[model samples]
Target: MGTFKIEGGHQLKGSIQPQGAKNEALQILCAVLLTPEKVTINNIPDIVDVNKLIKLLEKLGVKIEKLSKSTYTFQADEVNLQYLESDQFKIDGRGLRGSIMIVGPLLARFGKGYIPKPGGDKIGRRRLDTHFEGLIKLGAKFGYSREEQFYGVEAKKLKGTYMLLEEASVTGTANIVMAAVLAEGQTTIYNAACEPYLQQLCKMLNRMGAKISGVGSNMLIIEGVDSLGGTEHTMLPDMIEIGSWIGLAAMTKSELTITNVSWNDLGIIPSVFRKLGITVEKRNDDIYIPAHTDGYEIQSFIDGSILTIADAPWPGFTPDLLSIILVVATQARGSVLIHQKMFESRLFFVDKLIDMGAKIILCDPHRATVIGHDFKSTLKATTMTSPDIRAGVSLLIAALSAKGTSTIMNIEQIDRGYENIDERLRAIGAKIERLD
Candidate 1:
C-alpha cells in the first residue's frame, strides 16, 4: 500500500507527453504470440499491469529482449506449451485481465490454452463469455473446472465463420481477431468493437500479413493466412490519460498542453469535455487546455433540459473516462446527470466526492446528478482510498484542486495504468508526493 499527499491550489503549466495506450499495448503484446518470428514493438508503457503481462509471457517461454526502455523484440519460436498446465503459469496468468488474451493466440497455434480465474479492477462484472463463445464458434472446444476455477480451450484447428457478437467488447473483439488471423477460411465479425485500441490491433495484424478490413468501423472482415510474419508497430498515445489531464487542468485552473496526442484517433473525447464548457484548443497534434480562471460551465440541451452525459461502446463516450468527467463536473457552473451504463459499481466513488462538500445526488448504482459549485466554494481535502485505476486518477485530480492537503491511499491502483504519474505531474508543477 502507498499514499499520495497532494497540496491543492497549484496551477500547473507545461507540456507533458501521454504514455502509450495501455489497452492497445495489452492487445498488441498478446498478438505477438500469433507468429514465431520476431515482432518488435515501440512505445510500450512502463506500468504495473503491462509489466506483469510481460513477466507472464516470459514465464511461458516467449523470448523477450529489451532493446530500450520502450522498445522490445519478442520471438515466440521457443514457447513452452507444456508450461501452460503448470501451477506457476496459473499464478502468473491470474494476476491481470490481459493475460486472458493469450488464450486466443495460443489456442489458434498450439491447439490448447489455459487460464486461471483472472484478476482485474473490481469495477463491475466483466464476463469472458464473448471471448470463449467466439472461439467456440470457430470450432474450439471449451471447458471450465469449477473446483480449480480454470478455463481451458482446445481445437484440432480453428475454422473461420461469420458471427455477430452480443456486445462490442473491446478485449473480446481483439481476442477473436487474433484467433481468426491464423484460422482456415474467411471470418466476418459483425458488431465488433471499433475503438482505436482495436483499430491499432487490426492495423498491426495487417502489417504482419493478416487480412483485416473495416479498420475504424463496427464491422470487421478477416481472411486467414498460412502464418504471420515479423513486423514493427508503434502504439498511440494514451487517450484515457489525456482525458484525465484535461480534467486535471480544468479543476486546478492549470494551463497545460498534451503533446503528440494523435488527434485523429481521439474520436469525440475533446467535444465531450467541451460540452462541460471547458476550452480545448488543438495546435496540430497537441491539445492545449487553458486555465479556467472564470470557472467552467455546463451546457444544457437545446430543448432546455439539464444535460446528461453517459457512456456507450466506442465511437461513443468511453466508459473508462466517465470518472474524470464526473469529477470535473463538481466545479462546473451548472448541474449534469452522469449515467455510467457499462459498469455497476463505477459510480459509487461519488460518495467520496460528496464527502468533499460537493453537491451530488447518488440516484442509483448506474446514475448520479452533480450540481456544480461554480467556484463559489472550494473542496475540503480529506483522506481517501482509490478503488480502481481510473478512479485513482480522478481522486488525484480532485485532491489537486481541493483547498487543503489530501492523502490518497492504495496508489498502486493508479500505477497499474498510469506510468510514473507522480513524477510526471510534479514536473508540471503539481504538489504531490508518493509515500511508501
Candidate 2:
C-alpha cells in the first residue's frame, strides 16, 4: 500500500491535456470481444482499472499490441471463452464494475458467459438485476450461485424486444446495447442511460456496422445485425477528470487550462458549476480557468432561497461527480445542498470534510448542505484513507487546499481511474509525493 503526502495551500497553475474517458474505455475494450478483427483504440488512459481489464482480455486470448503509450491494437482472434471461468479471471473481475459488461459480448458470440460478482465503490447496493433482466428480455437465460457469487448467462439467437430498465444504470444500458447489436431483431431500450460514455459506446458500435439510433436520449433503438466488424476508435476525454480539475482550480485559486475537453458534452455540468460561481471558458475544445476567482453567491430560485444540486439520469449532473461538486462547494461563498440519490452511502464522506473545518449539514444518507468559506482557507491537514474513486479524489482536493501536510493512504483506489494523477498535479504546482 502506498500513501500520498501532500503539502496544501498552494495555487496550482499550468495547462493539462485530459486523458481518455475511463468509463468509455472500459466498455470499448469489452466491445472488442464482439469481433475478431483488429480493433485499434487511441487515447487510452494508463489507469489501474483499464490495465486490469486489459489483463482480463489477454487472459481470454485477446492479442493486444501496444502501439504507443496511449494507443493499443486488440484482436480477439482466438478468445477462449472458458478462461472467463478461471479463478484468476474472477479475481481480476473484482477490480471494476464494468467487468460485468463482458458477459454481453461473450454471450452474444459464444452463446454463454460467466462472471464473478463485480467489485467497485461501496457507495450502495448496486444491483445487477436490471442487467440480467434486460438480457433475459432479449432471449437470454441467467443462473447465479450464491456460494460462489458468480453469474452465468446462456442464449441462442437472441431475439430483441422492448426493454424498459427499472433504472437508468449506465453499465446495464451498455451491456444491453452490446448484446442487442448482434441480436436477431430490433431492440428498443427505454429509459436507458444515455450518458456521454454510453453515447460513445453506441457511436463506436455504429462505426462497426451496428445500427443504433437515439444516441443521446433516454430511449435507444438498436437494429440487430448478423455480424459486427472491427474498426478504429478513439476514446473521449475523461469528463470526470475535467470536472475534478475544475474543482481543484477553484479550491486552490489557480488558473488552469484543461485541453481536449468536449465542451458541448458537458451538459448541465457548466450550469451547475456556475451556481457555485465558477467561471469556465471554452476556447474551442479547451477549458480555461482564471486565477483568484472571487467565489460568487449561491444562486437560488425565484423565491431567493438556498438551491440544491442533485444527481439524475443522463444529461443531468453525473452521480460520480457529486463528491467533487460537494467538495468544491465547500470553498464557495454561500450554501448549496447536494443530493446524491443514486447511491445511499456516498454522502458519508462529508463527515470527513466537516472534521476538516468545513461547515456541512448531513441532512440524510442522500443529501447534505455545504456552506462555503469564501477564500478563508483555514483547513488543517489530517491523515485519511481513500474511500472510493470519486470520494478519494475529493479528499485529495481538500487536502491540497488545507493549511498543513496531509497523508492519504490506499491511493490505489485513486489510481483506478485518474491516470498519472500525482505527475499531472505536480505539473500544475501541487506539492504531492507518493510514499511506499
Candidate 3:
C-alpha cells in the first residue's frame, strides 16, 4: 500500500549497478536443494519474491547461513518431509511462483514433491502443465486435488526419458532439469528454454557432478548421476532491469551507465531499444545510455512498415520488458506497435499512460500502438495504481519524465522485482520519494 511521489523532468546522471537476475536467482536458489553439501551462492538480489522463496527453504529444514547481504550458503541435508503435508506448508508454498520449483529437486532427492497452487503476478494464464507433464514423463505419479487446488508427485525412483516440452517454459524447464539430473538414466530435453538463467543452472549442476551438455542451446542432454556435490555460483546481472534503465534514461533525457550487465547474455535487448532510436553503447561488461536530447525516434522496417516490438522465446524480446518499451516509446518520435503475445492483460496498463496524455491505441488485450510525443509535449502527471511488477516500473519511468508531480500507489508490486528502486533512482538524481 506504499506510494511513490515523483517530481518529473529531472536530468539523471552518474552510473548504477544492475541487481542480480531475479529469474536466475529463483532457479539457482532452488537448485541448492539438489545436494546435501554446502552450496554457496553470491549476487543474490534482496527482493521480496526471492526473500519469500528463501523463507520457504528455511521452513523446509535447509540449513541457511547468511555470509553477507548478497551471499549465502545452503545445505539441504535434513529436509522436513513431514512439513510438506502441513497446512502451514501449503500457505507458505503458495506465496510465489518460484515455490513450485522446489518440487523438482524434492521429488528427485526425496521421491515426493508437493505444492499448493502457487501465486504470482496476475499477468496471464501461467499454467503448470509443462512442469507436471515433464515430471510425469520421468516416471513420477502425479495427483491433483481440484477442490483443494493441490498438486503432488511421487515416485519410487525416477527413470530418465526424452521429453519434448509443449512450450519452452522457463520454470518448467528448470524444474524438469533438476528432476532429470538425479534420475536413473540419460534424459534428453528438446525445445528447452536456454535463457542465461537456465544456462547458469546447468553449469552449476555440472560443477556439482551432474552430466549436462548443451549449456546455451534449446536441446539439453543430461546423464543422471547417483549423487551431486555442492558448488559456488554467482548470478548474472538482471537484463530486464538493464533494459528498463536504458528506457528510463532515454525518456528522462539522462546519461546512465549500468555496470556488469553481461553483454553476451543480453540477447537482442539493446538492439530492440536501438529500433526505437535509442543510443546504447557497450563498454566491456557495461551498457551506457546517453541522454536523448535531440529526441528519440522510432525506426521503421526497410519496406516502410511501422516497427513492431513483440515478445517471443529466449532470443526474442522478453514479455517482462514490453511494458518498459511501451512507456519509453511514449516520448520517442514516430509510431510503433507494442505486442505482448504471451500475456493477455499486460498491455492494459497503457490506459494509465493514455490518461497522462500519451497517444496510445489499446487495439486489444494483446496489442497497443503508441504514437510518440516527439519531445514537443510532455506527459501531465497524475495519480495511478501499479498493476504488476514490470508495469509498475514502466509507470515510474513515465512519472519521471512527466511535466508535473505524480503519485503511484501499490508500489509493492515494484518492490517484488526491483531492489530499492526508489533509493537507487534517487542516487542518480531522480526526484522520487517513498511514502508509507
Candidate 4:
C-alpha cells in the first residue's frame, strides 16, 4: 500500500499540464478490438487504471508496443477470444468499470464476450442493467452466473435498431455506440451521454470508418458499416483533473495556470465556478487562476439567501466534480448547499471534513451545507483513508489547506484517475510526499 503525507498551509504557484482523460483512453483502447489493423493512440495517461486495461489487452493477445512515454501502438489482429472465459482474465476484468466497455466490441466483432463483475468506486449502486439493455437492443443475448458474478453475451450477427436508454449512463452509451458501429443496419440511440469523453470516442470511431452524427447531443445516429480500418487518435485532456486543480488553487489561495485545457469544451464549468466567486482566465488553450482571490459570497434569489450547487446529466454540472466543488466551498466566504443527486452515499465524506474543523451540516446521504472559514486555517490534519477517486482528491485538497501535516492511505484510488499527481503538485509548490 502507498500513502501521501502533505504539509499544508502553502500557496501553490506554477503552471501544470493536465493529463489525457482516463475514461476516454480506456474506451478508445477497447475500441481497438473492433478492427484487425494497427491503431496508434497518443496522449494516453500513464495511470494505474490504464495500465491495468493494457495488461488485460495484452493477455487477450493484442500486440502492443510503446512508441513513447505517452504514445502506444496496438494491433488486435489475432486476439484470443478464449481468454475471456479464463479465471485470470475474469479477475483482471474486475479491476475497473471501464472493463465493461470491452463487451460491446468483443460481441460485435467476435460474436461473443465475457466479463466479470466490473469494479470501481463504491459510491453507490452503479447498475450495469443499462449496458446490458442497450446491447440486447442491438441483438445480443446475455447470460449470467450468480456464483461467479460473471456476465456473458453472444450474438451471431447484430442487427441495429432504435434504443431508448433508461438513463444517460456514460459507459452504457459508449458500449452501445461501439457495438452499433459495425452492426447490420443503422442504430439510433436516444438520451445518450454526449459528454466530451463520449464525443472523443465517437470522433475516433468516425475516423476509423464509422458514421456517427450528433457528436455532442443526446440523440446519436450511428450507421453500421461492414468493416473498420485502423487510424491514429489522441485522447482529450482530463477535465476532471483540471477541475480538481481549480479547486486546489482556490482552497489554498494560490496562483496556478493549467495548460492544454480545452477552453471550448468547458460548457458550464466557468459559470459554475463563477457562482462560487472563482475567476478563471483563458489565454488560448490555457487557464490561469489569480492569487489571493476575494472569495465570493454564495449567490441567492431576490430574497437574498444561500443557493445550491447540484449535479445532473451532461450539459449540467458533472457528478464527478461535485466532490471537488464541495471541498472548495469550505474555504469560501459564505455558506452554500451541495446536492449530489446521482449518488446516494457520496455526501458521507463530509463528516471527515467536519472533524477537521469545517462547519458542515449533513442534511442527508445526498446533500450537505458547507460554511466557509475565510482562510482561517483552523483544520488540524489527521490520518485518513481514501474512499473513492473523487473524494480522495477532495481530501488531498482539504489537507493541502490545513494547518499541519496529514496522511492519506490507500492512494491507489487516487492514482486511478489523476496521473503524476504528486509530481504536478510538487511543481506548483505543494509539499506532498508519497511513501510505501
Candidate 1 achieves a global lDDT of: 0.94
Candidate 2, superposed: residue stretches over 4 Å from native: none
Among all windows of 10 consecutive residues in model 3, the one with the lowest summed lDDT is: 284-293
For residue 400, model 4's alpha carbon misses the true position, in angstroms, by 0.7
Clashing pairs in 3: none
Return the number of clashes found in candidate 4.
Answer: 0
Q: Give one digit per residue, the lDDT tens place, for model 4 in 1-436.
A: 8999999988899899999998889899999999999999999999999999999999999999999999999999999988998889878999888899999999999999889999999899899999899989899999999999999999999998998899999999999999999999899999999899999999999999999999999999998999899999988898899899888888888899999998877779877887888888888899998875565555664678787889988899999999998988888878889999989988888878888888889998899999988776457698899999999999999999999999999999999988889998998899999999
TM-score of 4: 0.98
Candidate 2 is scored at a TM of 0.98
Q: Candidate 1, residues 1-436: lDDT per residue as tens digits?
A: 8999999978999999999999999999999999999999999999999999998888888999999999999999989988899888878888899998999999988888889989989899999999999999999999999998899999999999999999999999999999999999999999999999999999999999999988889999999998999999999999999999999999999999999999999989999999999999999999999989999889999998999999999899999999999999999999999999989999988888899988999999999999999989989999999999999899899999999999999999999999999999999999999999
Each model's total of backbone clashes: 0, 0, 0, 0
User: How far in Å is the alpha carbon of 84 misplaced in model 1?
Assistant: 1.0
What lDDT does the true structure give each of the candidates?
A: 0.94, 0.90, 0.95, 0.90
lDDT of 4: 0.90
Candidate numbers, best lDDT first, in rank order: 3, 1, 4, 2
My TM-score estimates for the predictions, one after another, are 0.99, 0.98, 0.99, 0.98
Pairs of residues clashing in candidate 1: none
Q: Which digits, one per residue and each the tens of the lDDT, describe model 2 over residues 120-158?
A: 888999999888999999999899989989899999879
